[model samples]
Target: MQFICLIYNAEDNGPQPGTDEFGPYMQAYADYTQEVQDAGVMVGGEALQPIATATTVSVRDGKTELMDGPFAETKEQLGGYYILDCKDLDEALKYAAKIPDAKYGRVEVRPVMVFD
Candidate 1:
């Protein structure tokens, strides 16, 4: 089974790490990535830029609309995501909890859909 882990955090709050905190924070992520890779669970993942840089698009009445920011204005934004291959939802949740942002933000785990 494949799951998509949507990471969310406050854009204004920025990353919690400071100059000194960066090393450990990065190390933790590196370690987690390695562990999941060694287990053959990691499919793909990446950190995203701030919502301020996002462009939202919508189509209505055969017309296209473009907005300067994210689709919605919220304190927490869609920061990044991880797609993983796991045994089940429970297993995916376990891995999601290991994400560094899980302590301050949220990690939403959803099953991926497959089409024939």
Candidate 2:
């Protein structure tokens, strides 16, 4: 089964670049990525640009509408994601718990849908 682990955290809440904590924080991610890759469960993953760079779009009445940033604000923002191939939800959850952000942030794990 394939699962997507949605990572969420406050944009300014964690270690910032140029800070001592930043290096270890990023290294944690690298370590996690390597672990998953070595385990053969890493399908894909990436960290996203800040929410400030996000653009929301919609189409209504044959017209396109664009809005700056996300459509709504929240305490935590979607920061990144990991797609993993696992035996089942149990295994997926196990991996999700290991995600670095899960310590201070959130990781939502959901199974991928397949269409005929």
RMSD of each: 1.5, 0.9
Q: What is the lDDT, from 0 to 100, of the residue 27 in candidate 2?
A: 96
lDDT of each: 0.88, 0.94
What is the TM-score of each predicted model, taking all chains together? Answer: 0.92, 0.95
- State residue 52's C-alpha deviation in candidate 2, in Å: 0.8
What is candidate 2's lDDT per residue for 1-116, written digit by digit as tens? Answer: 89999999998888889999999999999999999999999999999999999999999999999999987789899999999999999999999999989988899999999687
Candidate 1 residue lDDT tens string, 56-95: 9999999999999999788889988989999999999999
* lDDT score for candidate 1 against the true structure: 0.88
Candidate 1: clashing pairs of residues: none
Instruction: Name model 2 segments beyond 4 Å from true.
Output: none
**Model 2 alpha-carbon miss at residue 108, Å:** 0.6
